[model samples]
Target: MSSPTRVYVSRLAGLPVYAPNGDQVGKVRDVVAMLRQGTQPPRVLGLVVEAFARRRIFVPMTRVTSVDIGHVITTGLVNVRRFEQRTTEVLVLAEMLDRTVTVVDSETTAVVFDMAMEQWRTRDWVLSKVAVREGAKRFRRRGQSHVLDWAEVSGFAQVEEGQGATHILAAFESMRPADLAAVLHDLSSKRRNEIAAALNDERLADVLEELPEDDQVEILAGLDTERAADVLEEMSPDDAADLIAELPTDTAERLLTLMEPDEAEDVRRLLTYEERTAGGLMTSEPVILPADATVADALANVRNAELSPALAAMIYVVRPPLETPTGRFIGAGHIQRLLREPPSELVSAVLDTDLDGLRPDDSLQAVAKYLATYNLVSAPVLDDEGRLIGAVTVDDVLDHLLPEDWREPDKPEEDHHAS
Candidate 1:
């Protein structure tokens, strides 16, 4: 049979000291239980010592009733008072209606869970009652409340690693899944899905997109179509379309059917084109202006709508009846240069009637070349019928091509030589 579990405490039940290492050793007085920040259900372990002077002590492991780490906690009191209000003492959450108490479960001498300051604070602490739990409730509040059981807590509730892993499990066994997920970064496919599913939809969406491609597919596969659609809808249309484009046709169709009508249509349109083409890479969001508006009005629209700077180029002026998707867009113009012109000037007057066009069907390589050849800071993208779709910027174009490890060395020679 497996060996019985062993638990250790740094504070001794009867021994109490006022100073570290009991320099001003005192008897164990009343113990103080507090709910410190970052702790759940609060803890009761530190002690009040009344030797030469009264002080609080923390009970760190390895130095039971001893001043191991030189430190002491104390409330501002010149002299100890008879039954001083415990509230005035240095405590966070002291008296609680409900509390969990741990006993040795074996030796009567062992106090599994108690209230005592670290050794330094409890130095010369006053010892009494010797042993008493306010309530009989005690088992263990271990594991992340939101995520997996046996979760380790660190900076945040997440999977702890290296030396930290062992510490979190041994210390903060009772932690929230959210607190743990915040700290965990790299996780295996199974673990990632385990946690992603446990988190609320919003957090699940956030973490799911950050996961590796294979893991992304695996996790998404586990979620029902409706849930999958909701998450993909939150992601940028481009990223969403890319992921969906990679799925099997039936799977893609299933998810798309569950998506919002408008968003679904947008993704379906994006999916129509090859993944490497401009249409495939382009965002469906676009900025459209009427052919009659003045430069000032157009500027206000861009500013008010919060369109990004990269969209400043290729400001399209369409003929009247802009509400119609198939409405004709007259031409393109540089909004920056137009800003210098008189505000009264019609946008059509400043529009570049001679600007070249980029149809959504064009390949990404062609789009890259368009930006390079024209020295265009950004360019407008339109569908086959001339409906403005999105503006492709040099930055977005580069991001599509560049890898994060561009500066890192090449991979193994087998992969390099093949290139």
Candidate 2:
């Protein structure tokens, strides 16, 4: 069956994208379009697909074979390179939704809510229709809604100052923090700041941790000092520390002072370590339980949704003071061993006490080798007094080991041909 010639872009968001052989590739996050001169409609370039590991990749329009209500099918060949927006390109859902434009006929201003792309020729798609609503006047419960030809709308070509991100946030409400960070990274600085400001503290913190340092610093700078401190409090202690280190010393101290005492202490402690050391990369808050904790208790601790898989993979056993810089470290218990043991069994019985713990001054290379040698996803770091201070996860190590620009999109390799 042939797919429809025209489809609303909003309906396409979140739809699963599949390969020709019926393999699911990813989900459609946004559509890429190139704006043309004057009133001509923008050419639909491709779809921004969130592939495995939350990597956003571009699926050129020519490679898409079908765009049905249930799913989008592709020609099986997908470029694995991360999608980096060109200056001439715009993301439809992210940049267009909720834009105020003048209705040519009425000369009245209306907010765009949705856009429709139509296939004008073989393999050629363009935005042809816009759905907008006029602002409701006093005494009116709702404003009038209209569907108009793309030509009837003005302001699509002009970048408006102080745009709101309500609709853009609504469209991507369900996206994970990492994916949302990518979306924000591709947007203009002003637009990105607007979206960041719209997000609640916790959501913004999660997204901030995933963004590059420059973006993180920029977004944090845009927020008021109090709000920035609150956002920092919501982030993982290690990540918050890393970000704070990037700011001017005075600015960093001010934010720390505004943060809750307990949270501020953790960040302060992390800042004392060298950047490429185990203490620098390890998270201050890992699942730490006393030796008396039962296997069931360990299981419960690892089940917390906020924990990354690597951190949850192992439970650190301590003598007392469950927080980081805890009392004498006893050992570590892998989640796998906990599951195999009787629920009533004490974690102490299954603890891997023989494993050596990392020190604050241990080099990143040393930490990586320790995990690789033991095939561990996470390992505990102990203080000079032999107390559990933190746990270094594999993900953190990889982040530092990769090139400084690892997060930024790279030029597609020769093998990943666009056609």
Please write out the lDDT profile of model 1 over residues 1-419, one tens digit for every residue.
Answer: 11111112222222434433325444433344433344232234344333332222233222232332333323222133212223323321122101222233422112112222322243322211112222223563333112111111112122232111222222223323322332232233444454455555655655554444555688789787888889888765666887887799999999998988888887887777776677777766655788778888877776743344676555667765553243676887787778888989888887887655687777778989998888886776766777666556776577567774332222222211111
For residues 302-414, could you state the per-residue lDDT of candidate 2 as single tens digits? Answer: 99998999999999999778888899999999998889999999999999999879999999999999999999999999998999999999999999999998876556554
Model 2 spans with C-alpha error above 4 angstroms: 23-26, 36-40, 50-60, 76-88, 104-107, 121-124, 142-145, 412-418
Tell me the spans in candidate 1 whose CA falls farther than 4 Å from its real position. Answer: 1-185, 190-212, 294-297, 304-309, 312-314, 320-325, 341-345, 383-390, 403-419
**How high is the CA lDDT of each candidate model?**
0.50, 0.90
lDDT: worst 10-residue window of model 1 = 144-153
- RMSD values for the candidates in order, in angstroms, are 17.7, 2.8
Which candidate leads in TM-score?
A: 2
Q: What's the distance in Å from true for residue 131, model 2? A: 2.3
Supply the TM-score for candidate 2: 0.90
TM-score list, all predictions: 0.49, 0.90
Report how far off residue 58 is in candidate 1 (Å): 32
| Residue 356 displacement in candidate 2 (angstroms) | 3.1
Residue 188 error, candidate 1, Å:
3.8
